[model samples]
Target: MKLLSPKLLLLPMLCWVQQAAAQQTTEALSDVQKIEYASPGVRGMGKPRGIVVEYERLPQFDIDSKSDDPEIGNGSARVRRHNKFSVRALAPIMNKPQTKLILGIDHSFEEFNFENVTPATYSLYNSLEDKNLKSVGLQLAFLHSPNEVNFYLVRAKAELNGDYTRDNINISDYLKTTIDVAYGWKRSPDFAWGIGFQLGYTFGRQRVYPGILYNRTFNDKWGVESIFPANARLRLNVSEKTLLYTGYRIEGASYNLLASNPPLSKFNDIELRRTDFKGLVRLEQEIYDFLWFAVEGGFRQYYRHRVFDDVGSRDYIIKNDLAGAGYIGVEIFAVPPRRFTEGRKNK
Candidate 1:
């Protein structure tokens, strides 16, 4: 039990989208009508403008036996599921309207299973049953506005994580890098805000964080979208082809394992950090004009499932439970023609 708590229904939808953006503005507002009333296009609820393919499943995800590893002679550790598949692409390669450039590619696949173990967890699923996790990512985006209410964003990303079955693939030892910048303000026609700083280099140190983003639109059926520590949502517009959301997200990954065997063969390389915290409910429809269909359900809170010993730094823990999951997705996108950003409408 104990579920419901999407920040308590997102604080009354963020106080009604900040009092409906301060009662529908008062002068000075343009920047393309304040970025179209601070987001409600690209199919509302943000994130739309190119490619994406998603798949997720968490069948069971249970494995709680609390072990400080005394050869796990009992207690628990069965884990029979947990899978994911993803593919994403975002491309715009510069399409001016006050500066814009984008290019992105991401790939992911995570699998975990035990098939029903027990021999004291069989040495932790026989060292993850021939490990070979995957991750590939790359992104570059820059968008500038300078007018229409100010906007600026810059991003750079790269990630190549993990266990390619037994080592022997060193793209600089499985890289991970990120850089981001932000500065946006629409502050009128329905609010908007941004601030940023994100520079990272995972698992081997180097980090710098600080971020905030916002979007609001209280009319057309409620709204609020955020990206702080990374994720937030509360949008409900069951019309214009449906939509509904209630969110929370925080997912992590950092893999690169295969230190030979037996408790990580004295260590030289082995790192598997996984984190999760989700509580969601999503729904989106729209079945034409570029297609869309989504359905989600969740509650899989298990922050961290560790394993580290990059040459004896020492760390181990494998089961952090609490699970539930379901999702279905399909999206084919490309938007921006409501008479070219909402104009000519008379017939």
Candidate 2:
């Protein structure tokens, strides 16, 4: 199968599963029943209810030099160390017996550096580095559950991303968007599975990437959490207030470029495509009911990093080797308040 074929095939399955599972949930809950609280210490979207800030220290990494463009004249490939930061806020906008709504915003910032550039290409490389990389996005999500065992999810986001160095920034040209829809089934108190596809435009192309979301606990001590083609983790419960995880994830983004300096300015605006695979180990500790801290370190393996001209032609490649890095972050969240119907008690 091709890179995106599986994702296309899974779209239909998502809808089918949503309807079937919801039917089962409705039948199972035919009689009036009280609410059931989720298992303690379950890490999920529902667990983090308010604000999150994450920062990672990216270490220097060696790059495998290969570019079709001869003007670059590269001797060696290396990416200078940099810092990455992101802040996210999520809040419940609406809550009802069978439907829910959430609104969120995620913003990120990073700077880029390419090491060991030949003097001949100095002006070009400097122009690229002078541009600051940033992305800001707003997210709207909806959830529908016929009963406790099954639910449907729909999330949409619009993002503004680019190197903000231009005098006349065309905000419309830099906009990026994504949509994800899925159905989930909770087979047991400790196990759940979901199927869905995330559709978006990246690297100057449109793609439909399908994935499976899953969470399963083998026992009190071991478990797995994963969304295939994106991330997967094996988790260990250390204590009531602590947890450990080892996992790998696929990460990447496409940024609009501004080649404003002389000589390189002839190339016009470019598109920088970056993708990486990371294997990591992380520790999470709770400080209080509303606060938590985490630290993680891992290897970053560059999978794809390339530059494309405005006409959608490949211009350069930034092949990089494996590098080690660390990250520390904090989160402040609220315990979700119980929902009540307008005219009747929740039961």
Error of 2 at 306 (Å): 0.3
Clashing residue pairs in all predictions, respectively, total 1, 0
lDDT per residue for candidate 2 within 1-347, as digits (tens), equals 00111112233123222322222221224368554322111332223335667666666665444444565434343557565667767765774546657687877777657777555355445755634577777877777766556767787777767776457667876777777777777666667787777876422344677778777778878888777767777888887567798997666676776767644466777766666667888887777654677777787766666666662445544332334444333344343222311112322
CA lDDT of each prediction against the hidden true structure: 0.55, 0.57
* Runs of candidate 2 exceeding 4 Å displacement: 1-31, 35-46, 75-77, 165-167, 201-204, 311-347
What is model 2's C-alpha RMSD? 6.7
lDDT for predicted candidate 2 compared with the true structure: 0.57
User: Residue 184 CA error for candidate 1 (Å)?
Assistant: 3.2
